[model samples]
Target: MTGARTADPPYLASLRAGYDRAFEATVVATPPEGVVLSQSLFYPVGGGQEADHGTLVTPDGIRVAVVDVRRMSGAVVHRLEKGGLVRFRIGMTVRGEIDWARRYTHMRLHTAQHLLSALAFDRYGLRTSEAAMSGHGGYLDLEGMLDGEEPIRRLEEEANSRYFTQPVQVESAMVSRAEFEAMPGRSSAKSLPQGISSVRLVLIEGIDRCPCGGTHVLSTGEVGRVRVFRDPKGKVASTRLSFELLEEREGPSSPP
Candidate 1:
């Protein structure tokens, strides 16, 4: 399949009410054979994890198989099987639906990661590197060593604290491409692209303001509970931090 193209929609942030408007959308671009769904909720694999897996539907009421999804040039692209592609054209609208089970898992894990980033900064004055959301779980690379279990446990506790304290809010703003390039911490970043009018910033209540293109839960509490799993390699210089979602009862909290 060809490289994915950036779509105007932001799957991670654009989600508000589920199934707001399901309709037929035509393929705006010349997609590869057997492809469907010009726009989708499937998040292409990036950051260190695999892409999303789901199905697609054609305008003629045909079901196309979405074998994989990926991100390209700020747009999310869906790759289909051989038979999935048809003689699609621009302005052709195809109905799109994501695997909610998989998407929700990713949402929870991604949000948990931000909370983990906040925990690292809040407790030990550490910063995160190389964060990823996966099917089984999620992981965030740390610049500092694990030191010990105490720090990890403490970070987990703080992450939960932030999750329950307030609602999570994410907003996007358009800035001059030059201004975006000059933003603090934008230079050292590895995953982000330079020079763009729109920047998607994620804020976890009183937590953080980092650029991200990943999907997240509407509220931090929606992440449920999180537990950090430490890698046994246990290299103090660098370590992989993983997390698992725990089911929790929702208390009365306002969503942002």
Candidate 2:
């Protein structure tokens, strides 16, 4: 893969990828241990989602711990733990596995973000100005001032109402600018990089649909419960909403 930029989008099949994570790929570049691959299972850090962490086991049984993944100059780069360079070499075949448990949590929270952001835009005319996600929880900053009393609670009710009424079946599609602009739930493109002509849209059915590159849950039901909280010392000029995802269980709980 030397000097060749990946022509095909680097990922698994959209339909099957919703549930599958493991795949085989060849090392096209090395030294830093993340350069190019015949195909990549790792989601590079972008669009408010963290990169995947896992182990790359060679055909000969050597293991390289993947600590971070990124993309530069159109090449996907996987930064490895110390000593990884000593164990890996170019032209080696390896099995690539993503940290699915952590990735899944981000997926759940990410999908929940789409629904919540859409609700803010649809109901309150607020656009998502910025967002971030991690394994445990995350937050979205809206592009408008929230003036009503108990706004966080109200947002939670609106989001959860739509979330619970629907199954969490997720669908992703690639489309041009015009096609994406036609979607109903489109919100602030803050989380997206500028100058992107093609759009990757992940839809939570009717609840929300937006341009995004982050991994999301297979469906909204997987999101369980969504709680919206406020930052202390009252509000900022633009509303910032912090949220957490809780799994379905007796009484109350948060995902571990």
lDDT of 2 by residue, 179-198 (tens): 66665554544444678788
Could you report the Cα RMSD, in angstroms, for every candidate shown? 4.5, 4.4
Candidate 1: C-alpha RMSD to true structure equals: 4.5
lDDT for each residue of candidate 1 in 1-52, tens digit (9 for 90 to 100): 3553444454544545221223344564554433434565566776554666
TM-score of 1: 0.76
Whole-model lDDT per candidate: 0.61, 0.70
The number of clashing residue pairs in each candidate reads 17, 4
- Return the TM-score for each candidate structure: 0.76, 0.85
Residue 225 C-alpha lDDT in model 2: 76
